[model samples]
Target: MNKPNKAPNNKEFPLTRETWRYIKRRQKELDDAFLSKAKWLPNDNARLSALLIERGELINEFPETFKWWKHKADDRARIIDEYIDLLHFLAGMDGMPAALFTMDGGYSRIMFEAETDKWRRLSNDYVLEQLLDYSPNREYPVQSACKVVALATHIMGRLGFTDGDILVAYDAKNAENFKRIAEGY
Candidate 1:
């Protein structure tokens, strides 16, 4: 829905919540295309694998800050890319609908469901800090990856990523994903 032909306007999407709605609309295309079976449940092994793969990709962008003078912000874009990649890893699990606004107190915590029609919250940051870290609590299924996506939006806010950037980038990725699925990628 981003209009790249015109000037960038963060106000177009305005809030993280609005951006999420946009994301979910596009995500449904993938869910429908890929998991069109009765009880289209997300596989635990697949989720964990995707999570770790994305997390490792994020880590690979790390550069040792041997000295304060040696630090570079150029990787900011790469970091954000990796963060979004992490969110995409959890995109397809059934749970609560996306929120109309950003989630509060989401720092270091992951939101998921542990039972039918039930929502439970947990944090993935603790496990992420460990090397070869992986969390296998499929019971703590990501009710909706939008929560995790919101966490990425929060990070983007910190790195000066405006609503426009997120909205545009997300739409762009969504289209690319659709193409990949169409091609059986």
Candidate 2:
């Protein structure tokens, strides 16, 4: 469990291969349960659309990330929740490699570094290009999905969340999702 008073520290819950594996496995379980309840087949296009929408929602949580004049205080808890919400959709996408989360000096760097608004804008634009303009025929869905995850992870880091923090939030959200399904949500 995450201690709310503690500062974000990637070293506390390092991104080991086992930890990445557990996250992937748990996400798959949640996806299976969600799909089973809805009786809906997975569609790549729809998932892509949903991922894009969730990305927008996550972006909405950080007005300070964009609006230079607005000096609102950071809402760490809400930001973490929205990040996990984005992860829920990301897990459903096919071919997202564990290396993106586990590898050294690659995607993991983006997840650990503090992002400036310029870099964030560039990353967001890159994701939009990959998802919207680059792959109309969906020929490279995995690549596009990878970019989306990269952007999401970068944003999470920007919000000062560690990989371990994400796992805790994901666990909590997964249970909430299960409960929602049980209640016919």
Candidate 3:
């Protein structure tokens, strides 16, 4: 008997509901594995706090979701708070998964903001000892606040803007355009 080798038609080989369910389960497993292995969080709070404070506000300030908190009250605030709690715990070396999981949007933002400020306040020398913070010079680190501010200014320089350039935009799109240009570099 000669067996014909042919591609299975979609209609002839319909995926069973259970097959979809199994596929979903495998997908979830893979996602979980990737997330678990991700280096999204620094090994310790001090470093984590520095990264968060330096970049946390930018996360919410993205054009797609910028100022979303101004409209949504309860849900956003709660999430931001939760994120704050996580940052606090993490910064203090007391982080737990449950605390992070319980955070709502608002709390998440709050935490992100707090971590940013905390890192902003620490001294350059303290960072070397307390947070193991690094500097290109190794022997001397510039003020963390100054470094962050300069980064913001340089980013603006990329889009034909300068440290003193003033932009006035009336609409979200315009504002976003300016922000994009400023941030593009």
Clashing pairs in 1: 110-122
lDDT of 1 by residue, 1-185 (tens): 44333334432112344454455555656667766643555564466457666666665554432123556544766765776565555544333343223332231233212211121132223222332233444444352333434333433443466766665666666677778767767
- Tens digit of lDDT per residue, candidate 2, span 1-185? 22233334543223333444555667777777787867667676677667767666666666565445778965778777876776666556634432223222332443335323324556543533332333323554444554566655655554456767877887888889889878888
TM-score between candidate 3 and the true structure: 0.20
Predictions in order: lDDT: 0.47, 0.57, 0.31
For model 2, the superposed segments whose C-alpha errors exceed 4 Å read 1-17, 68-71, 95-137
Which candidate achieves the best lDDT against the true structure? 2
Q: By lDDT, rank the candidates, best first.
A: 2, 1, 3
lDDT of 3: 0.31
- The C-alpha RMSD in Å for every predicted model, in order, reads 8.6, 6.6, 21.5
How far out, in Å, is residue 27 in model 1? 0.5
